[model samples]
Target: MADGSNGKPGQGLLGDTENHARVRTTALVIIAFAVVLFMLVQARFLLISLAVAIILFALTSDVIRFIARQRIGRFGVPNWLASIAALVLISTALLVLSSILLAQLNTVLVTTVSYAERAPSAVASLFGWMGEDVETAVFNSLRSVEISGYVRTVAGQAGNLMQGTVLVILFVGFLFAERIWFDTKMTNFFEDEGQAARATKIITSIIHRVNYYLLVKTVVSVITGAMIYVVAQVFGIELALALGILTFILNYIPNIGSIVATGMVALVGYVETGDAQTTGILFLITGAIQFINGNVIDPWMMGRALRLSSFGIIMSLAFWGAVWGIPGMFLSVPIMVMLLVVCSHVPELRKVAVLLSREGLPEDEQELDRLAEEIENRKG
Candidate 1:
């Protein structure tokens, strides 16, 4: 029954079977993605805390190991002791930071009423050059919105940060408890030394890359935030501390974040002062800070360490923001970094890793290929 151009009956039958198998696999993948998405949204609180805990563990693991290797009067600092110290430090930091952030959030929320009342006229004046008609139209449109209700909603959601902090602390404690046995468990689960070793390498690679990125980002963000805070204080803005903290938090979101923070500062200044010139000056100052840090300092420091595509970052930001809100936005880059590492270490998923990377090549390209091949061969 095989046509001449279609080749022999055996080849044609095999091709049909392969196509059928492909279709079934694609359908299964789609279904699995849908289920995962549903769970991510439904269990986001727990999942987010888990994700944060994992990142914290990765960041501090090296420090803990270093401490554990030290000798105190001929007795080594035990791993358990190091773990307990780290847990205490981490818990204290999270709680303290959460408290400070909540205080800033409350201050901003409380002052929001006055700001909102003056916002429309000040905002519309920014577009004064566009013509009076357009300015009036903008003012009327802004006037129609209920700013109070929106602030109230944000204030309500902000309260959940305290609860999330507690959950993250609990998760980190358990992670520390189990960290020692993780390697043994992985080896047992894989039941093959080589495979287990490869798995461990992949996980370590992910942690190292993620930890480096966070470290560089934190330093840069702190500088940018501090400078912005100084500028706010110089301008006599009442919410200097809150603005600084917001800038620090938003800077973690990547490209879109700095822009949003600058615009927010400009708007707040205008609403408070009702002076276009002063607002314009503050806007330029904040924008310069963001540009200098983000484009200059950040790139020089990060170099090829990040290797993430700008468009890919925006896409990740949008998708995760839609799914998990602001927390998702903050976590997007880390999640993408994890995905890129995992995918690059799998031959079947290498193409996806390329798409996620900046220059169509994941880190240590040849090494990644070798590791992926080894994994595939082992499975085969």
Candidate 2:
């Protein structure tokens, strides 16, 4: 029997003890994961606001830095001054956008109440072939729903939304204030300067990818919303504006959003006009629009930037949607991007990144590894 330390083909002195250690480690990991999951569910609102603020900060940080570099009559804008100005601008924009969304959502609720009286019959009409009894039962069941209770619930949620917006503003403000210390902090945390630099590059890459994804998505969503609005108006739908706004908001969610928006348009069309042929035509048109924008334009604009697997996307969507609800759905892809990048950089978690990525490769992992090695060799 040769010694393991000498690189001989023999078991170590501990023998199968290593297997026991692995089992314990796996059990501990599972317990830690369970605890983390519970905390996430409990503190969802705070975490969600923080995540939003982080994203907003990343998107605008470069602009703020550029502004800080300007020399106005030999007086360079200080970093703090640039940060404050950016915070103010962001706060104003957020408030305005929130107000607009609230107004739009309020309109939807009001119309929903009015349409509540009509929706049952409209929906029931589709089931007429199932027998008059079935149609009558559906209409009765729908009519029994308490619109007032729903309104009250939504109104309460609206208050929470306002609070969340304020929290996000505060979170962004703190992030901007802390931006100057980030480099120093990173340097101090890592013993090796090269490692610190690599970490910074990785963070920057994630931010850039997320920012680009958001920009392209916003453009595509706006285009889709406009087309939907025009179609609604042409069809003389009463809730044209509301439908457009909903479409815009929903399109922020990936995979399932476009389908929902298109189906919504078709449903509304059928409900309002009670014409099967008209509804079918409207569905076809909206579906075509969504397919063109979502499938064609969006991919072309994104290119290889978002090389996420379709199955992985759906899984992420399902998990986040279950845990965080609608907001989670909106933030799923960005979260997945962060996960993908982080996992790709970590050797042990590289397999997870492969699973998350489109082609079993998370970005240029080999190139980054090579670059890191070169930097280390140069330093040595």
Candidate 3:
């Protein structure tokens, strides 16, 4: 009888362990399937709109809170009212800027088409003078392509811009509403009060980090854009302001953005007057601005915010681009930032977050300052 009791308890313990393992395996399998299903559906446009809305809400919430605190005219503005006002102002500015850029883009496209038409002849003449087989090959390649197809493709993409704009607005409205209820709703999800408080802290930390990242990035992008515009004007490139705005928008993408902007500027230079010398100068100026911003200013401002490795960023870009196209690429870094923030809080995931970070932890101002000074001295 005693032996039977001992055997029964041991069997019970073994059964519990087996059950736990089965549960973990099942949960993992479900999560994997869900991820696969989401990718297969490719609902990227909707996801992008939601992501943009959340980012806009995070960035603007502080301004809204500040306005509410002012107590103007002896009556404080409500949080929602302040949020709406901020949203309206930001939306109006973006709309006006978008319209202007669209007009400029049309002009640039027409100019590009005209240049492409003459490219074959220009290349052939240069090749004839050089008597190089390579030149002949280049001329033949350029001549074989139909430029109209490219023009049509650009035109088709332009049509989609309006739809994307509308979606962004709708998403922004929903995100603002969600911000108001997020804390309360999240707290209610947990049974324990302590758990609720910890969840709130985690969520708040994530929001703060994301907001700071967006603010710094926006400032950096604007500076980069303004510099590009100024350089274009100095170089006498046509549509300098328009090109500057384009540069600002594209610079939101990490790693590959500067290359795209430089190529665009070179194309503008080539199209405006078909002068190779002018094109070369435009490319050089654009590259210089990118070099300064990407190497010096961006790293200083970012200060290990996302902490993503260069290889991680490139991999994320490729993966997201494959899954969601252009919208995916734009969202890739932000998603990575969110993951890093969450991972940093979890014991098992902290190692991954450390690998992603620049120094494997939050920024220490003194250390960063010392590094910056060293870099400056080296340059000098």
Candidate 4:
């Protein structure tokens, strides 16, 4: 009604519609271009490993900074030295874990193969007690499953795991070097020093959140792993160390990690002892550790730092895992955490962020006041 052409209200609406369409199209194109570029790079695994390494570096850097703050070194423990130390520590721990796992794996394989061959009759007899049909079905299923093929695949991958580990360490080392110069590099991106400083502050906030989340998650995972290991040892479960390490690593993936770890430990228990009771005990112990870690320790440590919705985590896990596999699953939560942080800063995206978060933002004062007034009137 305001205008028919020069200053029309309907014309403004038309223009707004066109502008919204244009913006949506532009955003879509930009996202498509990014996906195309990522595919062209063809470095999914490398990128995932690098991302994980950088997160780890960021988490450890805080500890290094803390030490430097105490004047532990003359030159305040250069970032490079701190990074190198962190890398060395991580690498050494990985090596020790790999050694333990490989040894246990070899033993398990040998024992399992022997058991399968020599105790086939025993297994059949146990199944026979259930029913003739059940025994037939069990043996048929076992025969159909190629255990040797699976063993070979696992062994081959384990052999190559060392190479992957080395690549990750090297990548993390470079990330550390880059961290030292990151502030200086970021300054060059902005024409105004003030703008650069503001950008640095934003980046620092992001880094702090990422670092804090990783540190807390890592500590919780380690505790869970140690608990699993001790419980397994108490139960006389073979491959306890390997299962413990596996639990620790998998625990990084939320929700489904404990389920996988428990099932894996139970399978190993079954194979090692050929007893359902032992396997059940193993599952119970692992499940209990996971319960404590997931429900108790993690919530205490996270304490609103993440605030990710349960549904958001599950969806991110599925999406990233589809795109990047196991590495994707491991990095999904951290990436989602990063996205939520950025989203929370923007007004429009804040709504979406609220949906993605465990809790919505605080209620507006007007709404609260209206509710209060309504309650008082109702009482009157």
Pick the lDDT winner: 1
Please give, for residues 1-380, the per-residue lDDT of candidate 2 as tens digits: 45745674545646667888999999999999999989889999999999999999999987797788789997899999999999999999999988888888888777777777788898888889999999999989888989779887887777688789999999999999899999899999997888898898788768878998999999999999999999999999988888898899899999699999999889878878888789989999999999999999999999988789999989999998988888899999999999998898888999999999999979665666665465346434
C-alpha displacement of 24 in model 3, angstroms? Answer: 11
TM-score of each: 0.91, 0.90, 0.80, 0.75
Clashing pairs in 3: 307-356
Question: Model 1 — which ten-residue stretch has the worst lDDT?
Answer: 371-380
Q: What C-alpha lDDT do the candidate models reach, one value each? A: 0.89, 0.88, 0.74, 0.73
Query: What's the best-to-worst order under TM-score?
Result: 1, 2, 3, 4
Error of 3 at 162 (Å): 2.0
Q: How many clashes does each candidate structure show, in the order listed?
A: 0, 0, 1, 1
What are the clashing pairs of model 1? none
Q: What lDDT does model 2 reach?
A: 0.88
TM-score of 1: 0.91
Which runs of model 1 end up more than 4 angstroms from their true locations?
Answer: 1-18, 365-380
The lDDT of model 1 is 0.89
lDDT accuracy of residue 163 in candidate 1: 97
Candidate 4's residue-wise lDDT over 1-380, tens digit each? 45556865588779889999999999999999888757834877578667867776766665666554545546566656666777788778767866776776676566566656534444554577789888887777666667677778777766766666777778777776777777777778786787676555444445666677777888998888898889878878767877788888888888888889888777667766787666677778778878888999889888866677889999999988877777688888888877776666566777877877788752233533444455346434
Per-residue lDDT over 273-303 for candidate 1, one digit per residue giving the tens place of the 0 to 100 score: 7888999899999999999999999999998
* Residue 233 alpha-carbon offset, candidate 4, angstroms: 2.5
Model 4 residue runs over 4 Å out of place are 1-41, 66-131, 193-195, 362-380
Q: Over the stretch 1-380, how does candidate 3's per-residue lDDT look in tens digits?
A: 45354656577667778999999999999999889858645776677766777777777776777777778787899988987888787677657765776787787677668688776766454456567787788788888998888888887777666677778777777777777887677778886777776656555555666776667778888998999899888877777888888898888788788799888887766656567777777788789888888889888988755567777788889887778776677777877777766777677887887876656783333543454455346434
